[model samples]
Target: MLYTPAPLHIPDGFLSILVSVVCWAITIIVIGFAISKTNKALGEKQIPLMGVMAAFIFAAQMINFPVAGGTSGHLLGGALAAIVLGPWAGMLVMTAVIAVQALLFQDGGLLVMGANILNMGLVTAAIGYGLYRSVAGQSKTVKLTVVGIAAWLSVMAGALLTSLQLWLSGTSQLEIVIPAMLGVHALIGLGEALITVFALAFIIQTRPDLIGEGSESAKASRNWVFAGGIVSLLVVLLSPLASADPDGLERVAKDLGFLSVGQDAPYQVIPDYTVPFLGETALSTILAGVVGILVVGVIIVLIARGMKAKS
Candidate 1:
């Protein structure tokens, strides 16, 4: 069976060429600015931080937790990334991760990569962080609450934008898709909130130096690197247990009878997140997960290092 590129992202045949082009245009514009801002904001030492963070996000997204109605959701990583790395840098990291997912891992559509990045990266980094900063204030307790709320709302906002894109593409009616998408994603959003809050809290406690202008000591940074390794290992070991149920968008598409509208791309290097020549096995999945994490980390590190050089 031909699968849509990513579980939650809008894929190939689901969107019209026009909608895809528009999404691409907007993504390009925003990413250009994101690159500029990240270059100016991040320093040489911070590159490794961003690199490990991207790897952690990539690995974390591999585990899909079960939700209601046989739907599942994974970490969108926008809110967590923004809170840790600052918004603009987070946006660039997400863009790189999504691009690698599509190009090398084939987790998302190559053609619709812009839309995937825009929805999952730009929207969350811009609107989600804005909401979080506005409401979080300075108190640590308030910040935690606001991050959770902002993370939940960011998932919903991304869902709403995706639904609107589908509606515009004539894949489904706005009224029908809107309610279905929002309803399923509401539960998914809760998962996002809880996970984001817990991760943020952990960082605050263990690596408070990583936040804001705080400096990370050599030991603390090493600990973070170790943590990233552990997270990646966990993703590889636990991904086999990820729920087999359809994710939020896939579930909505099935319910709305628009699932069949998805089109296969012209070519696939590693389609459906599966590694070719390995067959469908636990080993293959783990290998693919590891490969994706490494790819995302290496790409982001190279980008950051290149920028640091230029500066």
Candidate 2:
């Protein structure tokens, strides 16, 4: 059988229209603020960094590693982004990644895109940056520890927010959904934490200036950008090896009997990360992932440049 990766974000029909609209309003307002903040503070070096971060996150998200209970999980990248790009630009990069996932890959629902961005992008970036900032001037070990905690908490926060949204949409009972969602996600969060910590550790060792406040002082270098693009492409090449198990939300929805309610995307474009003509082959997934990373990277770069120009 062809392996189909389960849905990674909230799909249409999973939440009520009212809830979606509310999420859209909140996301729009926050994103607008993010744009303003980024425009004012964005540095020349940070612009390309945002693009690289978005591309890396987009590619990394395609590789869902197993997390137990027949479930799988992937890096959210918000913590890493926030730590590297700061909160405002981090939000923009994450927003670009999620938006592209929904629009180009059909990985998430268009109508529920706002909720997905809010949960996975804004909330994660905020929490990650908030907690990480607490360790300013700390030792490297201390900083890594805090980053791991922040990343784990970010996943938990995303899970909690998702549960609330499901409850508010009347998709499941609050009592059952909360434990179910959080329980499974606790394991998933570990995976998130590990990936985040390891990625940060690598950055700190090879390019210490890329982390946190150091990013502002770092000079722009084409070599770093080239290296980042290579890493993202390497990740995409491994896309076919990603576990095919249902992700946290998908498993939760299935267990709670609401899986059937998830409506399909109204249209298809590289649906399921497979080029239609390629017919579910490994090459198809890799090709689609490459396209995703390139598209998200360029989009983020363009957005960052625009913000910089305005500033």
lDDT for each residue of candidate 1 in 198-275, tens digit (9 for 90 to 100): 888998999987776333343433333343333333332322222222253354444333333332222431244332
In order of appearance, the predictions have TM-scores of 0.64, 0.65
Error of 2 at 237 (Å): 41
Please give the CA lDDT of all the candidate structures: 0.66, 0.68
> Could you say which candidate leads in lDDT?
2
* Predicted candidate 1, C-alpha RMSD: 18.0
Please give the TM-score that candidate 1 achieves against the real structure.
0.64
Off by over 4 Å in 1: 1-6, 63-73, 135-137, 213-311
Task: Encode model 2's per-residue lDDT on 1-311: one tens digit a residue.
Answer: 12233233888778877678778999999899988878777767867878887998877766677767777766778878877777778889999998887877677788888999988888788767766654556788988898898888777677777876776676866667766776777777798889888888898899976564644432332222233333233322322222222253354444443333332222321244332233345445457657977887786567445634543
Q: What is the C-alpha RMSD of each candidate to the true structure, in Å?
A: 18.0, 17.7
